[model samples]
Each structure stands twice: as structure tokens, then as C-alpha cells.
Target: MDDAQPITTLSGQIVQMGHLDGSLIERMRHEALTAPAPWKAEYGEFQSGGWWTTSLMNASGDAADVRIADGSARPTTLLQHMPATAGLLACLGLNYMWVRLARLEANAFLWEHRDYDELEQAERHRLHIPLQTNTSAFLVTGGTKVHMDGGRIWRLTPTYAHGVCNLLGPDRIHLIADVYTDDAYARLTKHAQEPTVDERLPTASEADLSEHLATARRLADLGYTAAAEQLLLRLFYSFAMPEGTAYDLIAGLHTALGDAEASKRWTAAKSTLLALAS
Candidate 1:
């Protein structure tokens, strides 16, 4: 996996599914960028600023209920404004648990974490449709970087550790759907294709880790606490390391700053988010 080569089907990666009409794709894009969404910022620790989401379908019919809950989903008011999106979702016909539009602004990041860990144990999958995205935006999973290109639906199993980033983007937006395994979903993914791009990230050596830690420390000493934390968090995107290395580094940074509670908090977060053995 460390070798620089195109990845095949693997854990925690996106598999390209069937395509959508170009015209429909355009409409989805327009609605994504123009819709009056009730963007909510949840999962604060799982992101590095600028990540927002609005529920289109959820257990509660409120768009602000972006935190996922396992239940029968109902349409939100935001979905009412998006006729094209509603129509498209209706056409596919799957058992949805939740649906949301996630937006990552320029320089934003979603830190490494597993999802659906808190939901009821059942067969579930996440589907993504890239409505608006830039080349600078991509997902890192299984040590491979995948730029989920538009025009097709993509399926992902988020039980494995993964992260996302938009380095220098126009905002990146995608319609994310969480669905249960059913006949319709089986048909939709029966012919799922391979992703177009799968680039392996550069491995981080001991020296690289030391240098980044030192830089973070310098920033912290200069009173740029948030910047220091983000610097360590961003390491996940730049190099391939162990599943929770960045979180460990962040905890270490807090310890060095004489904040024992903060250090403990990050340490606990790593365990919870990665679902590590107690």
C-alpha cells in the first residue's frame, strides 16, 4: 500500500457507481450553489473550520438536525427548495437513513475519523454525488487519495479511518446519502466502476513528524494555539501515517503547553473517533 500505484478495490475507499445525466448534474450543481440552505456546523472536533452541512433528509424533518440518527428519514424544508434534487433522489428510490449536502470551503479539512459508529449495528453504506468540487479537494483513505469526480454516484464504507481536505478550493459540495442495503441500492451498485484517480500519499518518516511537531510547538509558543492545532491536524492530508497519529500529536502538543486536561481530551477523542480497543 505504501508503493505509489493505482489502488484497486480496498477498505475505506470510494467505488464509482453509475452515472447521472449531464443536465441533471448541472441542475444539482446550480441548486447546491444557489439554494438557501440551513447550514449547520456539527462535529466541531472532526473538522478544521469551514466544514458545514444541512440535512435534506433525516430522522427529524428539520434541516438543522445534521447530526445523524438511525431512523426512517423524512424530507426537510431545505429539500423543498431543491426540486431537482428532490426529484433525482425520488427517482433512485433507496431506503435512506439520512441525506445531507456537505460543503468544505477553501483550506477546510475533515480530520481522520470513522462514521456510523454510534448508529445501530446494521448493514449501511454512504453514497456521494459530487455536485460542485475543485481539483484541490479530495479524500484520503487506505493511504490513497481519491478525487471523487462528478458525473457518477460513489459508494463508500466509512468504518475505516479516513479524512478529507480542500486545499485551495472554490467550495467543494457533495450530496451525501446514508442508506441501508436493499434491492434498489443493490441494483444501483451492481455495476459500480473503479475510481478514475487513486494516488498514494507520501509516507511520513520520523524526521518529518519531528519537524511538524516542532513547527506546531513554535506556533503555540507564539500564542497561535488554534493555528498550531490545525497544523498538526493537517498532517493527515500531507503524509500517510498510522490511523490516529495526528490526534496523538495534538494531544502531545497540549501536554507540552501545560494543559493536561486538553491533552487528555484529545487522547480520549482519538480513542472514541477511531473506535480503538479500550
Candidate 2:
């Protein structure tokens, strides 16, 4: 994959990827099996209860078997342990990144939604920085598309709608990481370079965000519903969580555009807000 071509998703966002034959993939796999940090559980019934469809890193960074050093487990925090697969990522100068081995079982899927706040903040570290943009895994063992081609490893601004499904017998695992700039990594190691609230607030300026909403609204006003929906996707990709105000505007726009699905979501959201207020 050329480092610059845009990789589009089934959901309409654009992302990119790196060639996967490097040493980092090997190192990560080695560390996954040999490292003492934590064990990634097989996709199956959880011992304690309902379907185990999603796994998350807590405020402390510890999962069922995973552990983040220094407890820097916040969603946007970079993990720095040198796993056996470190070389692949390091060779690309992605120093502040970490590896995640995820397994999504048969028929299992992730809904269409962007990553949460912290991860979005972490992503800012890679934003618009050419060399540091991230990619995902395109293949896995077993020669299967589910493990391989079905899910793409891309560095897209997917704060827009995106989803995945595992139709294969085995689970789907992804090695997710971000590109690290020399300056960013240096600052990251020192805990001094990450984006601040001031930086993020301005970077994700309301003007740019509003432009997206306005574009969608304009398209709807002109009767170009599909084009408007696509514009809405771009806005969603710009933020992990499109704010309540953004959602409210989207709801009205979609309603006017005759998109009941979107209107229903905003209606429910308003209902929830009303309930909270009452």
C-alpha cells in the first residue's frame, strides 16, 4: 500500500495501511503468547454471565489478563513495553504505539460508532501528520477472509460510521497501533508532548464541525439526501463522539431529509436527556 492513497471503508470513511510483512507482526505474536502481562481470552461465553462481545481497558488499564505499565491505561495513553513484535512497529518509527490482540468470534460484530474520547485524543497524536498515520491488519492465520480480508487495517478518520462482522469459525484479532512522530514519541516518553485541552478544543474547532453539519443540511435542503448523508459521515469521522449539539442538528437534518432511522436515534437521545432532567 502506498503511504498516501486514501483507503475507503464499507462505511464511507477513508483510511490507509502499511505493508504487513515486517518484523513487528512477528514480535507482537511472540509477546502475546510469551509475555506475562496478560492473556487474551478466547471468544466464548464468559464464566460469569452474558455474551462476552466487548472488552475494554478500564481507567486503570487492566483487562481480564492485560496490564498497562505505570497504569497508563487511559484510552488515549500510549503503551511502551517492547514486545517481541516491537520491531515491526519500531521499524516504521511508530515508537509511542502499542499492540492489541483482539478476537471477535463467529457472527460477532462491532456496531457502527467511532472510538470513545480517550482513544480519539490519542488519535490526535497521529492526525494530519503524514508519517505517523496508522494502519490495521489485513490478514491472519487459516487463509480465511474473516481472519484476513473481510476486516481491513486502515488509518481512516473513522469517527464516522464503521462496523465489522466475523463470519469465520475462529475469532478475529487485530493488532492496532498508531504512528509516532520523533517529537511526539520524545514528548510522550517525557509525558510532555501530548495534546492539551486547549490544543484539542481548537483543533476540533466548532467551525469545522459546524461546516460539516451545514454541508449536510445544505444537501438536504437541495434534495440530495445521499450526498448529505455522506457529508454527515465526514463530520462523524472528525470526532470520536459527535457532541450532543451535533447530534441534535443531525437528527433534525436527517428528519427533514426523510431519514427516519437517524431521526429515531435523536428522538431517543432527547428522551434520555429529558428523563435525566426530570
Candidate 3:
């Protein structure tokens, strides 16, 4: 593959993956909703309970490597059990790196975060096929809310900070695939649909920023530091802040609380998390 051409990043967050059979989607949804598969809860420090994932395909052949990757992939029993779903994957003909079924229970949230930051430099993308979802379940990316409707695959460039939420849902489930750029994927996405912005986040005024910082400081003082950090991190989805602004906010919050060491740690994390150069 030629390395000169820069991998295309969508002007907006979501893009359409080509069509899929509606019946297949319905069947997959039924299996997902009824299956007794072991759903592993999300273990990251940033999120609350209710998010779970089970792998269909991954690099280590272990369902637990939920993190993004840039290596060879293999399917797990979860994929084999649903032959129809495996058939759907075969139709795409793309070089997949990882595949999983992610379920978010009612009121669950994947707090604002960036992904693939720890992975090696490569042209990779995340695709979501909503198996079973409700209107309340949606993704916020680039400060725009998107509810990925069924019948078409949805692509998300997750390196940019984004979050998922299921405010009120029976259970939102999606077939998630991470694929590397290849001829098949390039051709499949050649006609990528332009993203429709459901809502654009309003720009925050200086006063608003100050108020938010104060709120975070109060939370930190109360010893709810993680909650404080999440409050600031969520600002990325609510305001049109520059990249890494959330990290900057957390660092500032620590500084205000007279925690120089904590402030310094967050300052360093900002660099490590947002650095574009591999």
C-alpha cells in the first residue's frame, strides 16, 4: 500500500457504510437481544457501570483485547455461533482488525474519550451496525449527536474525542468492527455519504468556562475527582473547544485545588493522549 496519500478523515464524525439486508439485520438483532453470551463490563476508570462488550474477532483471538489494534485478526466463538452475522462480515470483504458486540444498558454511558491513541500509526476506522437500539441511544462526536439507524453501517473516526450514551433503552446493541484501510474498504467507502449534523454544540463563553471550572473544582474538593474529570471531559461533546481542551481543563482544576503534582500529571497526559506523531 502507498503511504504517501493521507488517510481521509471525514469532515464530520459519522459516515454511511453501504447497504445491508434488512432481514439480516433483524435476525442479528434478535440473536443479540436473546443470546446468553457473557457480556464483559467496561473496566475503564472514566465510565459508570452498564457498558459491556463481547468479542467476535480480535488480534489476540481473546475476547478481552477490547482496545483498538493494527494487527492480524481472527474470529471467536461468538462470531461462529451467528453464522448469519458472519455472513454479513464476509460480504464487506474488508481487512478487519477487531470485531465485537457492544451493549449499553439503559442509562449507561461511555464517557468522552479518544481511542486508538495507544495503537501504532495506521489507517484504521471503526464501523457500527446497530443491531438493537432505541432513540435514546446515540453517539456524540465532534459536538454533534448522531443516532445510527439500522439498515446501513455507520463509520466513526474515534481518534477524535467522542462518547456514547443510552439514556433510556431496553438495551442498545451494535455489531462493531475495526478495519484497516485496504482496497476493499477504500472501494466500499468511495461513495461515503456526507454526515448530517443533528446538532452542533454551542460555543462556550468565557463566563461559562469559568463557571464550569468552578464546578469541577468543587467536585475535586469533595474528593469526587473522577466525577470532576468526567464533567470537564464531557465538555468536549457540549462545547466547541480545541483538541485536548478537556485535559487542559482537568489540569487547571488540579492547579486551582493546589495539587501541583496532579496538575503536572494531567499536563503530561494531554501530550501523550493527543500527540499526532506516532
Q: Which candidate is the best by TM-score?
A: 1
Question: For candidate 1, lDDT tens digit of each residue in 3-119?
Answer: 242222355357999989989999988988888888988999788889999999998899989989899998999899899999999999999999999999999999999998888
TM-scores, all candidates, are 0.93, 0.39, 0.83
Cα lDDT tens digits for candidate 2, 18-126: 3344354545544443444444443221111111311122244443433222122232122234333344444444444333545445544342333332333343332
Rank order (by lDDT, best first): 1, 3, 2
lDDT of candidate 3 over 17-72, digit per residue (tens): 68888999998987776655667875554355788888888877766657656788
Residue 228 error for model 2, in Å? Answer: 29
Per-candidate clash tally: 0, 9, 0
Error of 2 at 84 (Å): 2.3
Instruction: Point out where model 1 deviates above 4 Å.
Output: 1-9
Select the stronger candidate by TM-score from 1 and 2.
Answer: 1
Quote the lDDT for 221 in model 2.
Answer: 87
Q: Rank the candidates by TM-score, best first.
A: 1, 3, 2
What 10-residue stretch in candidate 3 is worst by lDDT?
1-10
